[model samples]
Target: MNGKGTKARWWARTATTFVCVGAAVAATAPSAFAGATGCNDRTCIAVAGSGLRVESVTASTTWNGDFNGHLHIYGGGIDRNSATGFWGYHQKFTVPVGRDLPNGSVLCAEGWEHTGGGLQLRGRACAEVHF
Candidate 1:
């Protein structure tokens, strides 16, 4: 084969291989979130806590609206903290626990959403994890 034809075939094979590899990687990649708790029709919260200290909190929703909201961490004698912002779909917040929680204490993560304009449509969900 001529040089031009050989180069064209090589490029075609390389492109095909790259496309297949990319699709495989995408198929095997882990989902962005899992183990959702305290879920309603539109919102859900996931919390990971150790004793009186919370490790992480994830809030998620499926509401399709221009809304602002927050993720709140509470319980176990810890001061409640709200991480607020314009939220859509998912938000991850870190909880800063200043003291150790008492035994048998439970930590809860709450997700709240409200309309940005007048006549708000509010919704909330909460989930808890024990250390």
Candidate 2:
């Protein structure tokens, strides 16, 4: 009945509407990194090489051991040393491509675990960069 009461009710309704809209949008929207590379099982990997001269590698492991493993990245114009002592739930590695990769170029990465004085495969993943 009062002006203040009407204004308060309007603000509350507006807030509720915004919340509902946000939830709806989130549910319907696709993943931001839907094209990202991913791996499964004891280890996981994701790569994004959309930038020039730099590529990102994300490696993760669920294995609880004395030594988690190492991240190896290869292919393209990027050649770097493997990451050692990759413990914990995840580890990130980066590679510089020196230049933009040609269209349909593929980059591969893998996680290796040390077992019984030998290296064993944990998880492997790869991604293709398109020019």
Candidate 3:
């Protein structure tokens, strides 16, 4: 009996299984800082403990002039939350050597909008720090 069809079907099943397992591992990786992310309609946030590098967070927003981005860390590693535009497009920031952080600290990013009243909080995203 010809076994070509059976071999092809077995190979397909094996490939499918591998793909599914790979995805599951990637999503539930032990490093929350390396796998986590937060997003909203106006913004997407990735912090030190998120999929982004452990030293920084990205204040992602539309490149339009109406939105301002801010980055902050809620961990003991930093002295204080950054002021407005500390990580903004207009400012030049240099990445320093990474620092060790106290366990369980969370890093967050906020998006602000230039409104008629004043700068109003638009959206925010956060990721918990994990070892």
Candidate 4:
């Protein structure tokens, strides 16, 4: 066979091998998130000083990127499960406050990433803010 024809066949074989390996890797990979059931909990909000029941936790979402979205939390830990892209966590719930939480209640939250066969909370937290 001609040298040009031999080179073309070699390239075709290499491409086929690449595709096969990629497919195998994808098929064996685990999903990034565990679905929308990881963060569903019924917990009441409480006062800062006395730990009095105040309000509930509610989960919200907003666009953070074109191909990726963010989980915006106001109250407590809501549904923390992202259904797409790399990795994500989302949660939503309700908190009972004395008509309006009386303001000044601490709103603490954080998101995490699973790596190295363990969980790391990434320190993506929001501090003392009213919902």
**Candidate 2 per-residue C-alpha lDDT over 1-131 given as tens digits, one digit per residue, 9 for 90 to 100:** 89999999999999999999999998886533213566644555566544433356555555452245676777666555465775566445655443556556566666677777888877666666653
Off by over 4 Å in 3: 1-35, 48-53, 62-97
Cα displacement (Å) at residue 27, model 2: 26
**Of the pair 3 and 4, which is ahead by TM-score?**
3
**By descending lDDT, how would the candidates be arranged?**
2, 1, 3, 4
What would the per-residue lDDT of candidate 4 be over residues 1-131, giving only the tens digit for each residue? 69999999999999999999999998886523111211212121222322223333333322231213323345433334434234222333223333333334444333334455655443333323232
Q: Candidate 1's residue-wise lDDT over 1-131, tens digit each? A: 69999999999999999999999998886423222356655555565554434455555555562247665656656436455677566544555444444545555555556445533334455544332
Backbone Cα, N, C clashes tallied per candidate: 1, 0, 2, 20
Candidate 4 wrongly placed segments (more than 4 Å): 35-131
**Model 1: which ten-residue window has the lowest total lDDT?**
30-39
lDDT score of residue 52 within candidate 2:
31
Work out the TM-score per prediction: 0.44, 0.55, 0.48, 0.30
Ranking by TM-score: 2, 3, 1, 4
Residue by residue across 1-131, what tens digits does model 3's lDDT show? 56998999999999999999999998887653433566554545555433234665454653332354343333335423444652333342222315545556665555565556876765566656666
